[model samples]
Target: MTVKAEPFDLSGKVAMVTGAAGGLGQCFAKTLSAAGASVVLCSRDRDRPELVRLANDLAGAERLAMDVVSHASVEQAFEVLDEKGIQVDILVNNAGVAISGRAQALSDADWNAVVDTNLRGAWTVSQQLAKRLIEQSRPGSIVNIASILGLQPSKGTAPYAVSKAGLIQMTRALALEWARFNIRVNALSPGYIETDINREFLQSDTAAAHIKRIPTRRVGVAEDLAGPILLLASAAGEHMTGSNLVVDGGHSCASL
Candidate 1:
């Protein structure tokens, strides 16, 4: 007897991705759209022509203005979606910032900015989505974008590391709590991926030295994360929750 494999189809599902203007968020938006999900690409400023162009290129794509750092902005975005009857079945909490400073020199504002956007903003979005899903009696999936630094800290990234660590814990807590509702929450932790934002840094001597230590001996690209993101966002991972999938090119293992 032969058995058929489960389909990873996300057809007819609606996906909302925060920070979809560029970088990993852009890659994520494209990936989700290619998988047949109606994607809502969100950014702080939706007026950017590039965003509009990207949205036009993807099937069932729409752009929206959303600032995860502000509660009002989050609520407004959701309201717009509600008005349009766009129910979000999958959420990619990919909006985050990194502030580089020595631990002792890190200002309160810098710390708060990173924490508020990465940790607090994620919570705000997740809470809102959870409420809506529960009210509608629907099962949903949430994939939090975390970092390898969250598991193993490095120098000059105190604020970023702390925020991502908190996010990892948040993923587990929400996953455990929301499982009762058939809602799945998981974290996707990526290592140093070469994106437009970090390309210059990755070319520097400091980054080169770091790359040599990795078992893969190469840096990752934005597209490298696409498949993993799709897996967690689609039915392929229905039985998975409270799990942290680390795609770090074995960098974390090098320490051992």
Candidate 2:
């Protein structure tokens, strides 16, 4: 009898993580590398030092410049990957932006920026990955990094929330349409993971009061999302397409 490899093991696989220069994207790339997948770190600038350092530190890792908000940039990046003969087996659509503003006060610029980066950008990237996978007749996984605010509305985050909500819906729709091709698409919605961009706010008095609203009584850290990402990226979640894995420390549950 032969022993099967662990379902979570990603040995010999390739994972492309967008927005991988820093924050949660960094953690996701590192985690996938640890699970034995060759990671492709993609960001607005491929030459970013942190991305280069990470690629150097990890085995079988490469860094690429890809701006999710720019279709031409995304296309060019994929063309380069094709030239390099790198077929991504797992795609993490983790590139997103959040602009805080009430619906009434939000400028068109603010709304468009958030919506374009968070929703339209994710769709563009996912579509590119899925198209390549289908053309190659390869099965793959796609993990969309979403937010609890997508499920539970919050004040002063209208544009961000709407974008994430659209993202969750996009994940479901893509999963439904691509299941026939054996491609899994899912959303991993985080509650409030602390990242460099939000560090100041997380330490502020306003955040202190807000923390109590969560059942866990604390906002999560970037490391908190490692498990959910792995589950979705590997064979462990092969049967979980179209599902939304909430990693919000029960925050979304309270609203439900």
- The top-ranked prediction according to lDDT is 1
Candidate 2 residue runs with Cα over 4 Å from true position: 1-4
The whole-model C-alpha lDDT of candidate 2 against the native structure comes to 0.90
lDDT of 1 by residue, 127-238 (tens): 9999999999999999999999889888888899899999999999999999999899999999999876577778888888899998999888889899899989988887
Q: Which pairs in model 1 have colliding backbones?
A: none
lDDT of each: 0.91, 0.90
User: Looking at model 2, which ten-residue stretch has the lowest summed lDDT?
Assistant: 247-256
lDDT of each residue in 125-179, candidate 2, tens digit only: 8889889999999999999998988997777889988999999999999999999
Measured with C-alpha atoms, the lDDT of residue 231 in candidate 1 is: 88
Measured against the true structure, the TM-scores of the candidates, in listed sequence, are: 0.96, 0.96
